[model samples]
Target: MRRLTAAVAASLLPGLMVIAIAGLPVPAGAAEPYDAYADEACDGYFDPLLLERGSRCSGSRERSCPTVRHWTPRRVSRQLPACEGVAQAAHPLHAERIQSSYLALRPDHGAPRAIYLMLHWHRATAHEAVNYLHLQDLARSRGALVIVPDVPGNQWAQSGSRNINQHVAWVDAVLADAQRRYGTGNLPVYLVGLSNGAAMAMHYACARADRIDAVMPVALPMYRSDLAACSFSQSIGYVQVHGDSDRFVPYRGNLWFASAEQVYARMRRNMDCVDAGAKAARLESPLTPVDIRYGDGCVGGRRGYLLRVENAGHTWPDMETLSGRDRNPYGLIARNFDATLQGYDLLQLAAGR
Candidate 1:
């Protein structure tokens, strides 16, 4: 497993610069992906061209030329089985279904203190479960139960009003079932999501604050629709992880030309914590320069932490191995970055808050 340093992470920014150069014109009638309240023409804040090129681009220059036709949702859905297979292999402890599954791991000693509700990226189910397991193992070591449920249709962000409400209902069912089985008061519940799933987690936090004590959204897009109804106060402790070189979610900013920092700033404003102070810290990583910015500039006493990986793409920070050829850069990055450590940090923040 190759580790990325800050210098390495910084080097990846040029790729984004190139994507920005090849920018696409915003579609006139594009429906916002998440919130239905937004204007239909407001095609998210992130650049679809950059995301498509960066995420799907591959091979040598001649071999990597853009396809003549655009991708359709149906086409993407056809690729879901591969991702689901990966998830199943990664977390054998978890029970699988057509749309979702559950992974259970018990601690070596005492009862768990918290239960993590892990969400997968678009078109990716248990295939990405290994990454979730890495965190689950750490949680188990610390006496925490990890619950990962697969969202049917591989939908994370509310694609529409119906999907949003359906997701909310599913979440409610899961929580209710968990409570009935394990006595809700015994363990704190936390939510974590990656990529579009991150956006979904934000939506969940906003709509179901009582169910989540904290949330960590990684490599997320900055879509106005996603944040349209989001009230920051509901997100008691928010930890966002992003890579500066992420082509899917560029560090330079979104199609709206807003940087991730700016997006968080907007979120802080919405949460009524606009005056919170931000402090910077470094994270342990084998690859890329990882820095964490935290403090109370956004929501009064409440705090937010942003993990920025320099020169990194759309991947997790510290994983041991790359799962597939098409794995998100940030997910690959997670091999080196410890989600367990992140989970613990969330626990601490939740305790303090």
Candidate 2:
């Protein structure tokens, strides 16, 4: 039941790793079945060109021709439902869907104070779902809407000029929808991403700082490879989190090169806060109960927080132990951290601007 495995770890790229869990405990209370708007049998739904590549089709295929179908609900349990909800929302938090984009929204319990747009890693619908659920539960408690978009090919950032226009278009649609639904006046908006999604979030934050209040890129690489066009002129806050023992995106440089901390430091320096102070500290959680803290005070005194868990690999921090695979007793760490609270805290810091 342990999620992290040597085989899985070995399959990951230099800056990223994948862990599979047998089963994680679902949240208390009866949860609804994951739903999708797209035809489950449709080929080229998420990746139109994927069909041409002759990838294996797990789901039912209508035509004999090779066609990629929708990733199953169970295969991508965490993301499908939320994406369905967002894409179907009358007033999406951010934007509308592009031709192949998947969008969904988790409505806030009470009047929302702000909106959060979350991006997921490569083909990691289940992780995205779990992360979304944790965030939704937290945001609903605080009255904030959460939006999760399944980017085409899971590319949230405009790396090459290839799909850049399409990516921006989708974001524009979602943001426009969010503004129409939730008055943009003073409602703070935040962008968060994990792994590849983190890269996308950083790309967006740098390029379109006007749209987001803060950016959190988790478990991304250090070199900032394939992401040079991202703009950093705007004054958007950033929080970078990574594990010290992460084999995927290691603390030290890896075979693929540049570490995540290095990338974050470069971004922080670009923001004109290179001389900020650093504080090493520890955080104790009921689950993992480990000592960890970040090198505080990055750009603008916003200090980057890196939670180094000894022997911990690439996985969401502070997550409740659902399976034996998750060694850290503390549940998803990010889940426990109230993003709304984080948003307000960042807003206070940005208020001086």
RMSD of each: 15.9, 15.0
For model 1, residues 4-96, the per-residue Cα lDDT tens digits are: 232133222111111111112333664542221222221211111222333211111111111212333233222222221112211322222
User: How far is 341's C-alpha from truth in model 1 (Å)?
Assistant: 2.8
TM-scores, all models, native as reference: 0.63, 0.62
Q: Which ten residues in a row have the lowest lDDT in candidate 1?
A: 56-65
Alpha-carbon local distance difference test for all models: 0.50, 0.46
- Compute the lDDT for candidate 2: 0.46
- The reply for model 1, stretches above 4 Å from the true place, is 1-101, 131-133, 157-161, 232-235, 256-258, 274-277, 284-287, 297-301, 322-336, 350-353
Clashes of 1: 45
Indicate which candidate wins on lDDT: 1
> What TM-score does prediction 2 earn?
0.62
